[model samples]
Target: MIETVIVVLHLLVAIGLVGLVLMQQGKGAETGASFGSGASGTVFGSQGSGTFLSRLTAILATIFFLTSLGLAYYASHKASAVQEAGLPDPMLQIEQAAPEAPVSEDVPVIEEDFTPASAGEDVPAAPE
Candidate 1:
């Protein structure tokens, strides 16, 4: 449950960080604001928006980093818990459960004929 909460907070903070970064104006945007582009009439006021958005972005980034660490800790903890449970690994269980091939006694075996050939037998000659 705590891990779930941390994961949700991490996602929310990540999205908020992206939105805050997108909302902030670039350095060159000041040229447009000076020429009556009306950027100065924002809800947070002219200079206020810059500092407020930057600070909020920083806070969200910190939260995102912390939640990432929390999630990693939970993952490692769960892995360790599984190890402590003394359960056999699934792969080993699968190999142990497989049936071995059956041996058959009906198949005929070839035997070598060690009898000497008669003197009149026609044997192929070896290559010279």
Candidate 2:
């Protein structure tokens, strides 16, 4: 459940990050002369980033980075000691009861004389 929550959070952060990046206006809203324009001076200043969308984009990007680092750390450290996920061992199964002891010393084992076929030697016989 915790892993599910973390995965959901990671997905939301990724979507938000992509949306924020796509919604941001590029450095040049319009193409002026090829040479460096005066407008370039104000691009990185407080004026450009003061916009609400820019602020939100920055915040969401930070969250995306934080979650990415956190997930990496969790995968490396927290998951190392986790147990193998599988069905319970058959020897410890509780549904069946223990077997009884052998009843007679002279009882012949029915399959004692039979030998198992070799891997490549056996071609199964079809039905009669």
Global lDDT of each candidate:
0.84, 0.69
- Best of the candidates, TM-score: 1
Name the 10 consecutive residues with the lowest summed lDDT in model 1: 39-48
Residue 75, candidate 1: Cα error in Å is 0.6
If candidate 1 were superposed on the true structure by all CA atoms, what would the RMSD be?
A: 11.3
* Predictions: Cα RMSD each: 11.3, 13.2
Model 1 Cα lDDT, one tens digit per residue, 19-70: 9999988987778766777855678876648788888888888888889989
Candidate 1: lDDT of 38? 85
